[model samples]
Target: MGQLLVVRHGQASFGADDYDVLSPTGEEQARVLGAALADLAPDLVVHGSLVRQRRTAELLAAAAGWDVRLREDPRWNELEDLAQFAAVSGSPDGLDRDGFQQWYDAAMARWTGGEHDHDYSEPFVGFRDRANAALADVADEGTVVAVSSGGPIAAIASVLLAGDATTYGRLLPGIVNAGITRVISGRRGLTLLSFNEHQHLPPELRTYR
Candidate 1:
């Protein structure tokens, strides 16, 4: 059985003008996680096409002293719904944090309802399909680590566990920054071994945003 470690990118610059970049805390979180996972000796490391994801992988490899080749795959990218959310909710520009979360939750529901597949920024089913395909493509005969966002990681777990998008959405809030989810692929295909493991980080380092 080959192991696939799906790692959520570190805490991003939430509420910033550009949310794609990693914050100072995010860079530290990635380095700490890399040091923690150094002994795993992953044969390959991959990340989504997002800047945050790529930066996380690069920092992780540098900290871990792993010279493995890094690969990029857009199929593992997170489900983007910011534009769709704005379209559905008249924009959350002036909303507070809680208010923004409220809008986000409702927007997530609509996106996953399978109704706006035609016009959503990214179709929910297509996202799920691509996440599954990315997981399948990397589960080779060695340890593989994938750096991604919470949505794609949750979607992967939900699909492997035979659940629906609701389950995937439910997982989003709990996935810590730099958390790890383990899966194994064998004769029976992929099996989820663990989810959201962050014992490597202390309470202060653990972040969800």
Candidate 2:
């Protein structure tokens, strides 16, 4: 049997100019999770091409004292593009975080609703299929750790649990920063062992954005 431990990247620079970068809190979150998982000593460390995902993998591997080289897989990339997705749903100007979240939820619904596939360059189905492909490509008889974003993580989970991608957007909001989800491969194929495990984080470190 093989195991895939997927981690959502730590807290990112939400309101900052570059949202792809990790915040100070995000850095500490990675360090903490690294320390907690030091005993696991994963066979491989994989991450999305995004800066934040890459940085989290680096920090976690370093903190865990593992010499394993990190692997960059663009297939593990995020599906959400805040500005782009919001605009697709007709978001108004000057939306606060709360307001933007509201619009983003609506946007995700519209994007996945199947009626407006033409609106998005990459439809929701495409995102789900690619993410699932990426996961299948990485599965092996050893423990593999992948650092990615909430969108892809939720997408994979939705497919495994619900049998498709239509409901992934609904699972997005609950994915905390640096959250852990475990999937196992056995005779039955990929079985979701868990989703969104964050007990390693303290109350202050638990953030979803």
Candidate 2: which stretches are off by over 4 Å? 163-166
Residue 67 CA displacement from its true place in model 1, Å: 1.4
lDDT of 1 by residue, 84-140 (tens): 678765798888989988988888888889987776667889888888899999987
| Error of model 1, residue 15, in angstroms | 1.9
**TM-scores vs. true structure, each candidate:** 0.96, 0.94
Top-TM-score candidate index: 1
Tens digit of per-residue lDDT, candidate 2, span 1-209: 99999999989998798999999999999999899888886789999999999999999888888888689999899976655575576755698878876887677777877788877878888888899998998887378999999989998999889655456766888999989999998888898999999999999999997
lDDT leader:
1
Colliding residue pairs in candidate 1: none
